[model samples]
Target chain A: AQTVTQSQPEMSVQEAETVTLSCTYDTSESDYYLFWYKQPPSRQMILVIRQEAYKQQNATENRFSVNFQKAAKSFSLKISDSQLGDAAMYFCAYNANNAGNMLTFGGGTRLMVKP
Target chain B: DVKVTQSSRYLVKRTGEKVFLECVQDMDHENMFWYRQDPGLGLRLIYFSYDVKMKEKGDIPEGYSVSREKKERFSLILESASTNQTSMYLCASRYPGPYNEQFFGPGTRLTVL
Candidate 1:
């Protein structure tokens, strides 16, 4: 069994600043995929970024980047230049071998962006 | 753009009532999924269908059933809706391969009284 853990229940950041959301997972599979999804007040889940376990380089999407440490089993999301729209529930997910295309998600972190 | 839509955005039902949540995807995806979200608990898969007429149980399949008569639509059913079943239901679809991102619907907020 695999588990994704997001320890921070809530987080806050000032607008235009940077914030990092921590995530860790327990998986035995060496090959896998990590993802971060943002859920806003509209109740829509949006993809933030994705990182392949085989890739040594971190995954980045505009202001959203990931610090993926495969050896440490840690994948963190770094949001630079945070805006009000960035305030949402962030989830860290894991997908691995024989998982049947299913995603294991963390408890989620509620982020609030302050003006 | 891929679009996944649910039949309803909000629903209220009483205990022991039969509840059905419908989901439809427009991207011609082969895989469809049903998940329930609660406060503090991210998203837990309730059921998934890989193809038409094929369904699989997820992490929390208890008290939940699903239907997939067609490839584009997946239905989640609660034979006897309970108060514990009240939560946000989400539908998603994706390609049949690994690493493909799953497109999500707006979600249905179900309340069981």
Candidate 2:
């Protein structure tokens, strides 16, 4: 079974500053997928970024990027130029190579963007 | 744009009563999923369907059942509601591919009294 763990329960960042959310997972599979999702008060799970285990190069979407350390089993999300709208609950998820794309999510980290 | 919609935004059910949560997606996705969100407990999968009339148990399937009569619709049923079942329910849909970007519904907050 694959499990994702987010060590930080909560974090705060000033607007326009950068923040990094840490995530680690336990999986025996050699190939898998990792994702970061954001859920605001609206409770909509929005995809932030994604990384494939086979790709050593990190994934980036505008201001959002991932630092994927496959050997270390760590995938961290870096949010640059944080905005007030960035305040939300962030989740790190894992999916095995053969699984049905069903995600195993972390406990989540609540991010607060300060003005 | 893909859209996933739930039947309700908020629901209150009594203990021992039956509860049904409906989810519909317009993107013709081959997969649909139901998950429960709890404080400090991320999103836990309850059930999922790969096709019409096909349902699979997820991490936490106890006390929950699902039905998929149509390709675009998936329903989560609680045979007997319990206080422990009170939580936010989310529905998501995604295509069957390596690049899985699921579209999520607004979620239904179910409260068991």
lDDT (Cα, tens digit) per residue for candidate 1, span B1-113? 99999999999999999999999999899999999999888999999999999999999999999999999999999999999999999999999865889899999999999
Per-residue error for A94 in candidate 2, Å, reads 0.6
lDDT of 2 by residue, B15-106 (tens): 99999999999999989999999988899999989889988999999999999999999999999999999999999999986568888999
- After superposition, the stretches of candidate 2 with alpha carbons farther than 4 Å from their true spots are none
Candidate 2 residue-wise lDDT at A33 = 88
List TM-score per model, in order. Answer: 0.98, 0.98
For model 1, the stretches where C-alpha displacement exceeds 4 angstroms are none
lDDT of 2 at B91: 95
Tens digits of per-residue lDDT for model 2 on A1-109?
Answer: 8889999999999999999999999999988889999999886789999998999899999999999999899999999999999999999999887886678999999
* DockQ each: 0.71, 0.71
